[model samples]
Target chain A: MAKELTPQEMLRIDLTPPNKDWMDIPTVIKPGIYCYPAKPEKVEIVGMPNPHVWSPLDDDWGLPEDWKETFLEGMRERLNKHRSFKIFMDICVRCGACADKCHFFLGSGDPKNMPVARAELIRSVYRGEFTKAGKILGRLAGGRKITEDVLKEIWYYMFQCTECRRCSLFCPYGIDTAEVTIIGRELINLFGLNINWIQEPVANCYETGNHLGLLPHTFKQNIEFMCMDIEDFVGVTIEPPFNKKGAEILFVTPSGDVFADPGIYTLMGYLLLFEHIGLDYTWSTYASEGGNFGFFTSLDMAQRLNAKIYAEAKRLGVKWILGGECGHMWRVVHQYMNTFNGPPEFLEEPVNPLTGTKFENAKSAKMIHISEFTADLIKHGKLKLNPKRNDHLKVTYHDSCNPSRGMGMFEEPRYIINNVCNNFYEMPENTIREQTFCCGSGAGLNAGENMELRLRGGLPRANAVKYVHERFGVNMLSCVCAIDRAVLPASMEYWVPDVNVCGVSELVGNALIMEGEHDRPTDLRGEEIPGFAKAEGEEEVTEDV
Target chain B: MGRNLHKGLREILVHKKGPIVEKWRELIHKSYPPETAQFLKREKDRFSNPIGSSIEDSIWPLFDQLIGEADPSTTKKLLDNLVRVRAVQDFTPASAVQIIFALKQIVRKEVLPAAQKKGLLREYLEFESEIDRFGLLAFDVFMECRERVWEIKRNDLLKRPYLLAGGMCPSYMMKRGIKHLEKLKKEITQH
Candidate 1:
């Protein structure tokens, strides 16, 4: 018989963070980690190796004869290019103020995981190799030599860290441990030893359109399935436009949302809402995933992944793309993409085709969040919502980190939740809104092996949420990010057992007004929201917000 | 038994206290430009009030304790001042290439060994060869230390107080370095 899956055991094997530290590490491992079962392997999946994992160095996985020269040159380049690196190198007071902050340290009880000590792993070597005191008065003076062993330890320890940057917040000088991890990863990549797991997803993203390796046809099939789900779940033949040329708005979502549960539910809400509103929108299988794992790996990979959006949008000749709720996707678009990809000439500045109000010079492409769009429609009296349809469960919204911190998307989702749900309680401030914690599985560490770390990492968020669930009787955890749907459920199932996770759209789908022949009387227990009939006056359009 | 020693070593570093802190105004003046430093010092009461004392007053006890505890073998205090002179022989060059050069010297020779003897070195140097191979140089020291840390025998190393003491060593000590008596005192006692 197959061994029974204990929460701890399954979490260790599935989540990719090193397993040895999970039980003993000082950090309290939250139940939120290990959100999914590890995919069973039959024949090992073979992927093409990208020869360009390293830049300005030899491509081999081992040190070449000129390794020292390569290493020095790489260090000099990093020092010259990033002021953050220089500040990091110069400013660590090693006061150990950041020691208690790392979840890995708390979970593993390994002193090496302590942020200050972890930094010293690099700082000591940098001092020993680059400066005068380091050369002669080595260990006593604070200098440490970088040997082959040091490199391997760096690979092992640095990779274990999630690059959360929480440590940086408390740090007096703002030393980003994530930067150190990136530099370490860059060095290891120089050696060509990017293990098969992470590299495979990156490779798949390059070959197929998504990290999950779903081809365009498969992607289209999933979208069609979501439309079918909308028909079944909410009584409407909600036809979603896929790959339609010259649509007013091109809707792009993470492909995972199309294939998964609550995410698919959110997608269904969008389809039904769009159909009811008579809005022109299309879903692109080409730009399927808004959540880019490439941003986590390298700057170049990030650029490559983002470059696809413009390519597909231009091909479709759409005006202003609408991005789905994803953490890093919003971060990349808001922080980097608008500047990186220019002259969105393929899409004109979004004009309220209804209001004729042009949103020019929008910081983020005039792309509207679905939550904001839905809430706006509600505010304009476009949809008649029965909030009592969602009265069965008390729901609370968990802010996706990128939208909360990356873009100031605090209000939109909450607006939808308040308008649609009969009862909604706010998660404690420490765990919600701008200070919201990650789902413990964002940034593609959602694999089975890293689940324990995810749980451990997500403890702070889980604990805060659990307090409300225990005291306030909150039953649902709602968020906008698809990955939150994927990861937070597992976390909630384990740690905060009182709550079930749902999308803001799932609630909207539950309460959405399906327009009828005439304005009908609204009832709490038994009537469907008015269903959508074709809108009149398409000939002489008037847009009023 | 060895693991117990390792555990003991960790305790030493974890428990080690640094110098009793003194002279915050002087130290603040050293890191920041005069205007910023003066403003910070003026606003020192604002920071220290909730925490109990001015950063200048608060940090001194810790600094002085670390300085007082530093091994006399390596660091020598001046007759009239709290400034401890680290002997620049065998490890650090007498003429520094840069300010960090002096730090590299003090860390590799005096600070690291004191840490090592007390079992604190394990955190900084996991392998025996890390101590051996990265024989006290700047970038190369980091390089060698990196190599040494990966050595298999590093698994067997003990955690000690000297290693813990290293944790108390400020980031400044590894950079431009203990230019003043108060900084020296803080560094000595903090561990």
Candidate 2:
């Protein structure tokens, strides 16, 4: 006879919450979820406070002796300095409108990951420490003292946010929840609790002028290697100048484009496009990075890293600056760069030398995005584009969170795609445009140890791609972001293996019909063009037969 | 293998498919927090609530495959859709596949009475055994997804050796007492 289960035992899998409130639920820091803590040396290099070795898994994080006072003091300082932070904390009515909008919440199904609750993790402490009624009434007034566990919980969820601002878009009162997370991270960094994936990049960007810390020679050599590939594949020999003074424009891009795959192809696209137009621009080794990891750490650090861009431009005496395909780089540049390091008085307003169109939108920053430049060029019929070159690719666009929401660059990339790729499709309306989902690995959260978090957060974006893949046979997903180029390939491979990720410039490079070029046998990646090269297995099958 | 027994089990499973799938989905929804479970249950749009929509879109075809033909290819694809979502979520390996086992309980409650009256209780026991096998298959798919996640993590690290090489910053090298910064830089360049 088989054993029988009792009535209570029969239904063993119970997932309901405990009798205690969410505040009482202790955070369990799991491996493969949190990133490695920042190294002490990296922290010390930046002269940040309380440099020490620590782990999220440790019972004691080895915080400074005055950690509580330091945290409260930081919070008080932020509340005084940034009125937006103070208003965001005070204005939220617990509307829950932004609760379901977070990708982390949607992916993980954790209530704490909800924007409202995540904010309340800090808000509760604020009320307890700052408000008179809360100090008097305690838990009755929806306030709690900042225990070590509370600090731990705040740190856990703050880093979980990508600061993509998706949730902020949905907030009725315009809470700007990303700012809350930014301030939360700033406070966390006061104790040197930053993650290595972010801190190392910040230190490297400060010391060597790029996130990957490639020295001037190595950076130039990497671009030269890409030039060699362009020569081999496109039958065009080009020498892109580096740090050349008196150039008309200073072209800066995230260093990922120089060193990483897919992004390097986009860099190749930039080289080809510039060469085709005979535009005068120089790459700066000092401002090699456009993306700022310091933006994820703190505002002051972001300003420090971002100062190099304008400084390089002033030194080079370029007329204007043109930025490349990157996500947060644009967010920082468009929204915060001018405020951080500008009134770039040394530079002139950005004007498309090829099209002769003055970019009024970028007049203040004296910087223009690559898509803005390319779109203007195409609109004016400046380039001879062959859309048929991309016929083999059925393409779709992923509105990288920053460019879409932060910059409102909705039509430029799509207009460029229409001119380049014949088979362009939109994902479901809700998942695109201003409502675009994050690639999940934004901010500094795109580290290897946080793979589970990234994958779960990426599901919505990947699911939208899957829908288009099934409906429209969309195989290639393009975007105007280098971080997307770096991370989306892994997400696409995991969620929808059929779709491949690429930069928009890669598509432009494919469709570009350069003067004095040989009959192109391949795209920028050296994969054969559909009509140019023989189909796969055709000759082999004939030989076998 | 008896023809009448197969016919009886198929008819009962097909007739009770609606309630069976609903109860199974409800149990799966329970696996999340109460507020999120309510949201996932209430929201019907596929794009706005993909997690919910994936569960809804998959369970119907999954049930049909379970009761009708049990085609391995179709069933595996359907299971992959559902299991892949849960694999990256905050579930342990056992809890991740436990959703499949909920169907066993649902069947025992919904089909047991009818099967007993129709003299098909033994067939029902065999059917439960089939559910056990399906649970085992779901476990395999879950593990495959978990392994793929690890593979992706490993590949991401390998793809960006510069990040790790850069991690050996000059100050970090000094702190670690590694004197050969030049050697490490050479290796990174070669890599």
Candidate 3:
């Protein structure tokens, strides 16, 4: 609501003859549109280089006198080291195929948020400093020398991007804008500028073996507390082995599953599911978190934190790893982990111990998603499930950004949901599966200060859910990511007030007819289990696995 | 006041509500790029254009409230539905509520000739005063919505410190649960 350009006074941008000098018009790096900077102490705790303190709103970012040279030097180093970075910088035709694909652009209607324009922010810097054609032609060749304002503009939009890679999917040349953002962020971090959301978690994960910085004792307490809930609800006890050496598999998941609500329910789902299947999996407090927040900050930081997972797996003598539902974690596990800190030679391929269904998709990474594991379980009829128990929820699935586009595991989640829930509806074809819209709050942009930005980015996704909510009475939204569980509830509150956001596991927990479990009358949150409350009042319902 | 002024004004404003809404939509969407504006300006199909369709949906009900009943509760209800949405947009309070002024423009364009020809300037002035009153009411809704947005932002700021310290996205668990239950209760009874 702070005043700036009124609607009538703002410049109207049009698709015109190729503009030779894009920098002639300064990008409007608006006030509320940017993120707060990282606290230097947190950056230092993670042992990152140049951990100098700065805030985005300050007049000066406390850069060293040689900050520009440092950025340029880092750019040169990356150009030499990563051929993909050099080629991505060199080869953009700007056909604008990716312009409308970005949720940030579609939601905010900001020209700079467009994928093409966002890439141009750093691409311009690349041309001016690195290319001969740019050095001679300067602004004529889409190049601009870096300035204080230009640095701020670059940092501002880099954080704005969730790096969901939906844009990369649409690029005809497949010029990944995410690659530009990754290296662009790495170069910018040479001077220690990072959003607190990303840097703080990186620091926590480095020191405490988890993003939430839960001590080993406290982490165990959280799991035990959930165990109590499971005992009271199901009349069955679950004592998950933690840091137990010689366990067959290492069970790792995002710590948000332990700390946040509804997510806690899904954690309960894992405990219940593992207990039911009698899988010999062990939880490790050392590699307490599966999510890699460092992946958003810098590659070195990501590698530093991700080292804990494989290190813990080795120390525990586990054969393979099974990951819980998360988006970016899978992205790192599937795409970057092996390249960064893998070959994980000590670990074996993931095979479902109960049914021995080998996960071919994760044979190399030695990790399998819980949905794939559970879908195969249901396929082989290893565990009991009651589709009627979840009759109350006419549900729709939100494909999280990384798993859908980054790994392409579309039908695994849908297959599980269809088998568990009676009424399931897909969002519009364009907004589901591979072409799925973001939860609008991925990649550590799920901060509270940016609620307006989050809401704006969420409009397209919420609109899609609302379509199904109105048409099919879908009061529940199920997803596969802990970030979605943390952020989408707030997004739903603003956009579609009636739809409740939850992890797919919460629904699975509700519907699973576990061994030695009591008759179910309520859901994870103690909400009346809709139609079941009536059925239970009149008749005792019992099912078996 | 002319004998037929109110009826003719209603005919002009109400009968031609389609163009009035279209003109209002154009004014509302003038800020976005033309291509994006096309999406935001779609008057039908809530799925394709939820925000635009919601804005368009308020048009007739608001007109009925403004001219026919002029009840404060009814006016507040219609405008609050739209104001809550516009509050979150990247615009100042003045600019956000500026959409309501489109009503005055629509009245001036659609009924000015009829009112002048009927020599009902007194009745027309009365109608203009009513719009001014509703405009003031809209200003109130806009201020309240802006305050609510800031309130949410302030609460977020308080909770964000914890997220920084421990990588938590904080919210009032009790409040969220109650909100979920309230909506659930409403849904159950409604069905």
Candidate 4:
């Protein structure tokens, strides 16, 4: 039997901070000096020499030696072809500051998963072989001759990074690891090294306009089902508009949230709020996926994935777009998509339909967050909520990285929680707002193959929640990201067994007040919804629209 | 090892009988303006380079060579040309630390010395300070790129290893991953 490797034993080799003036820089010193507390001091791994355990994904990954030539040719073409890519390449410095900031690295004890190191899996080669460093030092300066193995190593590692720009925040060079990952994936894709799971969804998103490949009819069917769930959960028959042309807003959300988990409940919250406030919104099956998996692999894929929303939005002819709660979806939308693609032809300037306020940054203005919109509605007394409905449990909110860090959406979700829930507790100051930790399973690392790492990385976050749970008896954890919903539960099970994770909308659903007795869907059919329907016409408001 | 080789070459260059003073005169003429350059030439000997009586005196001429400025383009051009010379070119103390200290005057004050120890003086030169944190050069560089840095320090949960794990940071994870590959090999052989 193979020996189990403990975290302390693995982390025995510590790079003692070389005494220096540069070490005084808050960003550099904070991590190196304080890396002892916030960052993992040790990583534990068992079942090592699994020579028998071969990754079928790698075998089918279709990466070959010729991939090096193909990738280099592609990189050269990109560098020569586009000014932005060249400038981006020249401007990038592979400082590892962003590496420790990544959720994937935090979750998985795998060092190859660090943003800078993962980037170096490609950038080092770029530095050594492509730059002046290669010409002079050759191999002595850590420059190596690029080979097929180098390309494969780049492919394997770069793909593992979720390209979450959490690292970009700390990167002294402002080198977006996600952007590097995008380039790496693009080079790998040139040689056809895409994983089957991600590629299939990307293809589905291309073909059916949703990652789940839901047909237009099925898409409508899901909306109808959600309306029924809302009637059961929120006591309102919310008919969220479907492909309504010339509508004021087009609501684009990740298909994952629309299909599964806490995101579905959050989806219901958007529908109920839209109905209560009488906002003109539509959902186009064509632009169904706000989350771009293609952004994970290639910029062309990112451009293509993003192009779908505008194409469909134009087809539907909405005035402006509203984004749902998902991490990378908003990251691509706010940071790259609006810049890479041209301004929308069909969407007009988004005036907050309720407040009459105009969002200036068209990227975020045109792309409004659902939480922000809902919070505003509640603030303005548009939607009436029964706070006691959420009395069954105490809840705390986990700020998703994209919405909070990517778009500065810290207040919107908190506002909704404060108004909608009777009892709500906030997490630690450092762990909230822009400094909030990732759910540890974002950036497409939520794959089944990465479960071990996912749980490990989630430890920090789970421990944080455990603090709240233990102190305040907070039973539920609420966050707005779908990936968080998918990954956080696993962490809760492993690290904080008692705490339950839910979407903010789930608590809202529990707390919504029924206007009419028929709002109870479960009583109506015993097939759906939840409770007993009261006498007919007791209230004029109808649950079924 | 590389530094020692460079030092050995400097010693050999200094010991040679060839016009060392003339070389100094040429450097001063190239580095300074016509007025300053001429003054430096007149002060030094025309034939033999004057050996400094002590280490402090010897470094004085090197300092004059470094900071006594002439035309910017011409000075940079001379430095670039000097950097290309075979012995003093790549192996020069100029490449090793001089230009970096000069740059430190502009962007940062004291980064060049520590940067030299890591063999990262060249790489660090490519970066300009953004945030201006004293020791946190990385954050400063990041801020220049318009990036923000956030720290998650553990205040209470010191007992739980999860809260304080290093892999929580992706950079640490990558470093750990590379470091662990060695451990994996060692552990594998141990069994």
Candidate 5:
């Protein structure tokens, strides 16, 4: 600078890391990466503890006077209560098998985003406070006392994880890193440190029985709007029942499908499929939402929100429940719901009334995913099908993380896709099925402000889709999760502009030939089928004659 | 404008392409943490290690484009492919585009001695200026990619207005926050 250095010298960049331990490297809270902190009113509405206004960027988080005690006691209680938590904390052999398995690590290239380092953020504290050796030998044993910076680092990286369990799939010891993140989040919520994107949905689900905070009438009207679209597009009029007693099945879907585009098309598919099959199902605005955003907050909140479904089912006297296409909702239903809210003796085991197929796997939870139900219908040849209507689309399936890893219902959605669409291709093997990448916006991280994080975390999944789009010409990314329908479209638009995202049932709606229906010339979204324009032109010419 | 100068520059660049690209790739890998850099350098698969594979795939073509006529469209396509990935990662605009400038340092170190021996130092300086221009172009591409990210984010918010605080739903307007609901309702209906 003294001699006015040349631009070449000024442009020099040294990217080497400072020679400091990772523990000493303070976490820098950046905007556009982390979600906004939860509003105190939302926390208060849900009866969570320590409601306060705090910022992630602030030096002081305005923790309660007894925050350390509260946090440590919360950790202690969780460790004692959950044997998996205690075992995960106690397990050793820090093998690096799971280091490269995380999409966030792959996309962002942040070592802390690696599942091992992420778990260590909490595991270090667990060792420091709980284990005797860590207490005696401090940093030598890879343990550190909890500090404000440590707490901040924990909150930062824990939310960075989508809890997709992809890392856990690769853990040689089968250590569930998602469970660590879940417990980490639970402790963070003990001090009211949740992000608004998650807390608002949890509060909304608690208050109005849905994450979108949709009122019952507004919810019904939204669906009626879809029904009207079905009438105008598909030439069908079917009045869907709501809150009616003695219905054989009570259908629950994520409110995202009712509110968001492309997801609404999936909802319309459910309606038409049910109408065609003439199944006795009722929609309950009380138990309207199938998604449990509270699962992102804490186990108790998850169970609290999930209680509505079983309560509504018992009240409506429904025999069993049919869940719509969703990601985390299935994780809750399959893994935790029965343990949290079950032994549902009042409700009978879920059996496909149309196909006479008993869902023995869902015997306890008594809730069958829509894909399983629809696949059984196609298997029994119970629905009129025309795969030619979807000729315009070269489809590839993305297995939503929860259903593939948590529920192992891989073949059902694939079976349905093969039956409904003529042209189908699979993405790369490692990126599908049990090892499927996240949509990067799951676990309540799909907020507007955190778009950069979402995009970075979405790279691995989008990279695979880009491969298929380039090699096999895949135009439609069909998935079974409503969050995938809501979020994957944005990722697709950003990474692979040639591909579009939709739900599996939307393809079904496009291909289903309803009885006594008028001549259908368009897909479910009212886009004209590729070969239908000539037929419509012929019709117009005949009419003129 | 002299044909000999262009030929001499091309010869030096092609002769030294291996060391230059290897050093440039090392600098790019250094942008990440030590452990992550090790993993990115070790993994060779494109799908499993997309960021590393992308950097490897783009740098060689980019080097070739730099040595050749430097077609703006082809350069932009290659730059966009690389910068697009970096724009979304944890990178400042300067840090993101700095990788492009690191190539100049590599060329100067690797090609300068050969050019000096051949009395083409002035031509090599011109080539360095070309790298400066490419670096500036990289900055433009980074900004464009970032703007596209913001546009995608804006579209997401407009598409899902319910995610907005105090949105259209009555229940969303908790604790006397109903003033914006009508406006939000209009926005939703318009959408």
Candidate 6:
């Protein structure tokens, strides 16, 4: 059952700002709007502060005895440590350019979900405590004390943000809301408060080297299981090397690829592509997950989980790392990995063996996104592609936020998609590339109780997809993010029913003509490939769309 | 009781149609942020003010469709653009469809005085059922939209139960289930 918000609340068209102070406008902490709390044990495992039973929906979340002091102190430390925090705090002109750009604000119509307003949630607190104007002229200076209402508002709106940074792209000062939210969330986590969706994965990634907490044997068996699918469907025997010593490259992918359905197909695509080129890479159970869920919470957690990739690569004696197609993983590995983990002096810069092209951007880090690798291979005419195999799919590409905005590797994915799929249509120019809307559930906010919020926040993305789907007869929404793979399917189902969601690599697997493969009568999902059934001398039924 | 309630309901639906439509549109328009709402509240042009246009398209036709005749297709066609926007909004099924019933409230306030004055209780009662029927139809559209929401979720789950199926710890069992489904799909397609 959907929780009800009055039409006046959701769609009130009044233009005037309330005469009352913002904090004076009462905050209703709605159920199914916020995530469940992290278990105390999980908080303990991560050694995060304020480990205790609590709920965001409750009036009194279990907090430290001096939670206010702790929060202010933590804010002070973060402000001193990171200059961006101080600058972002002081520099907001609140021009409102970034307001309508947010998918959450556009979808839910919650004014605070707007980037400027969301930033103001934290900025207000900063104004009250840190700034002189805020201290003296509190409410007038947009300063609100860190009261329980403000704290609850912080939890509600901060988690609501996907940290997609679409707002930053439009900001006159390039003020990244993700950085603000990241610091804001980290400050919140000082109370040992984290949502289970984020904390559980962070805990699991810490303990099991992956988010799903797959045991070493279970991890190995899962990869082997997908290989069997390849053998059965494609008739290609792919013995993907697992922790093989002295491999040329260490391939790290999000464990969602190995565990989930559409993502598993993408994982299969990686294996087939690797085997096709006789890629010198090994899959490490230790460095299995490329997605750093800790990234959603704090930089320290991201650093801890990301440490596995370089450690395993060093141990395996691999030259460089070839990252799988994932969203925030690329954001982390490309931007934050080197800074947090270190200069991996052991691994050489990523090189395409066929084209002998060195990835100069990844020279210091020595890691390249799989799209970059695949596009280079395709450009050099390395792998034989049969694009017509994907003709059944009138496809549209969803640019995952982090990679498109964070790394700006915009062309690489489209290049691969165009090469692999024939009937590809770009989602509207404004919605695609840098100005992309989040799938509404990035940053580990994909839990079920919050499904209504997720669906609402996802409307802009879904609406854009609907335009392409209705116009181009687009049936598939493809992206490079595992979170998108996990969440966009639900968004598509809710908004645009006929369209399906998949990873870009899943398209690659379908179109790829494997060496010594059984005529892929079906795509990796076992659905009949459009024209393949008719060609197989079966009843010439209308091809499944 | 039923006769009295029906008469009371009808008095509003027929006599107060104008105010009812105005109030309903006002509520829908108010759904946007204050700035957007202020412009949308006044903007009369359909092109410049699509929200205004949508209201004109959905509400006026909706009133005629409900009060004039039982043309479901024409009514649906008229309301589809407007309701679909609401359907995707961050609304509960109740709130999303509740806008449909705001007319009934306006009908009560506007038509009640006239019905009592004219002693047209019987005639007024007839309009009551008519608007109820429209409310039912509005519910039908809302439910269908909601059903599609759930259907999309169910269909996605059906497409790949593997999301929940995995981490259940029996690796071979999940594989067998996948293999079984693949074979079933293959057989169905073959047929």
Per-model lDDT: 0.55, 0.87, 0.78, 0.55, 0.87, 0.79
Task: Give DockQ for candidates 1 onward, in order.
Answer: 0.01, 0.33, 0.20, 0.01, 0.38, 0.18
Which of candidates 3 and 6 reaches a greater TM-score? 3
Docking class of 4: incorrect
True-vs-predicted CA distance for residue A157, candidate 6, Å: 1.0
| lDDT tens digits, residue span A369-441, model 1 | 6666666667667777878767767888888877776667888788888988878998766556655666765
Q: Could you estimate the TM-score for every candidate? A: 0.61, 0.93, 0.88, 0.61, 0.94, 0.85
Reference-based lDDT, residue A392, model 6: 92
Compose the digit string of candidate 1's lDDT tens values, residues B72-163.
Answer: 32221111011101011001222111222222333354345556676666544442233222123223433332233222112111211211
Q: Top DockQ: which candidate number? A: 5
Give the Cα error of residue A206 in candidate 5, in Å: 1.0
Q: What tens-digit string does per-residue lDDT give for candidate 5 at A413-471?
A: 99999999999999999999998999998999988899888888999999999999999
Judge candidate 3 at residue B161 and give its lDDT. 44
After superposition, which runs of candidate 4 have C-alpha atoms over 4 Å from their true positions? A1-65, A79-96, A233-235, A363-365, A517-545, B1-191
Using DockQ as the measure, name the better of candidate 1 and candidate 5.
Answer: 5
Summarize candidate 2's per-residue lDDT along A1-545 as a digit string, tens digits: 12355877665655544545787777877777789999999999989988899888877888888999999999999999999999998989998999999888888888898999999999999999999988999888888898788998899999889888999888999999899999999999999999999999999999999998888887887788778778878878999999999999999999888877678889889999999899999999899999999999999999999999999999999999999999999999999999899979889998898778999999899999999999999999998999999999999999999999999999999999999999999999999999999998899998888999998889889989999999999999999888888889989989999999999999998889887776677898888988978666655223345
Best by TM-score: 5
List model 4 lDDT by residue over B62-173, tens digit each: 3233223323344333332222111111111222223223333432333445446657555444433211211132222223221110111110111123212423422222
Residue B25, model 1: lDDT of 29
Q: Rank the candidates by lDDT, best first.
A: 5, 2, 6, 3, 4, 1
Any runs in candidate 5 off by more than 4 Å, and if so which?
A1-13, A534-545, B1-5, B160-191
lDDT of candidate 6 vs native? 0.79
For model 3 chain A, give the 10-residue run with minimal summed lDDT. Answer: A12-21
Task: Please provide, for model 4 over A289-330, each residue's C-alpha lDDT reduced to its tens digit, 9 standing for 90 to 100.
Answer: 888877765677777778878777777777788887788888
Chain A TM-score per model, please list them. 0.78, 0.95, 0.94, 0.80, 0.96, 0.95
- Provide backbone clash counts, one per model: 139, 0, 0, 29, 0, 11
Which scores higher on lDDT, 4 or 5?
5
